[model samples]
Target: MQLQKKTRSGSFNILGISIKLSIVILIFFGVVFLLNKVDFPSPKKTIEKIIPNENFKIVK
Candidate 1:
């Protein structure tokens, strides 16, 4: 009766919140991936800089 109706509505609200959170997570990861692909270079360069020179020694 009344309890059933409330449960249904609550389920829908929970579903909507889940969808929104998932979208936000996806967008955050997408932006990170795009930035990485673009050679944004912050994290990558920082790691490279921290490593010893032998680690970056030219292969050719």
Candidate 2:
């Protein structure tokens, strides 16, 4: 006669979530690192916005 021991599948659920979270955090940090090393061109034109005074309401 042979016997088999069944493992609990629920016990490793948290471990899986933690591993996924760490991988996401690692990828985010890697992207930030690469972005820091890059130099992007600045805008050639100046942005101008005209805000009408009527849009502002004075509150008592």
Candidate 3:
């Protein structure tokens, strides 16, 4: 009787863990889907800089 209880409890634990894992996966995908639907702004201004050769070091 004790052995039977142990096996049944182990199965229940596995089932619970799988359910929680699937829920987490679903929530992650839902967040990704919502983010895809939204539009984000892009940077419009362009800046240019020139670096002098004196700032660089030559390595062997």
Off by over 4 Å in 3: 1-12
Give the lowest summed-lDDT range of ten residues in model 3: 1-10
Kindly report which residue pairs in candidate 1 clash with one another: none
Better candidate by lDDT, 1 or 3: 3
Candidate 3 per-residue lDDT, tens place, 1-60, comes to 355434444345778789999999999999999999999998899888999999999999
Candidate maximizing TM-score: 3
Candidate 3 Cα deviation (angstroms), residue 23: 0.8
* Off by more than 4 A, model 2: 1-12, 43-60
Residue-level lDDT tens digits of model 1 in 1-60: 355434344335778789999999999999998987885535545433466677676767
* Tens-digit lDDT track of model 2 for 1-60: 889777766456888899999999999999999999999999999999999999999999
TM-scores, all candidates, are 0.46, 0.49, 0.66
- Clash count in backbone of candidate 1: 0
lDDT of each candidate versus the true structure: 0.75, 0.92, 0.87
How close to the true structure is residue 46 of candidate 3, measured as C-alpha lDDT? 89
Q: Looking at candidate 2, what is the lDDT of residue 46?
A: 100
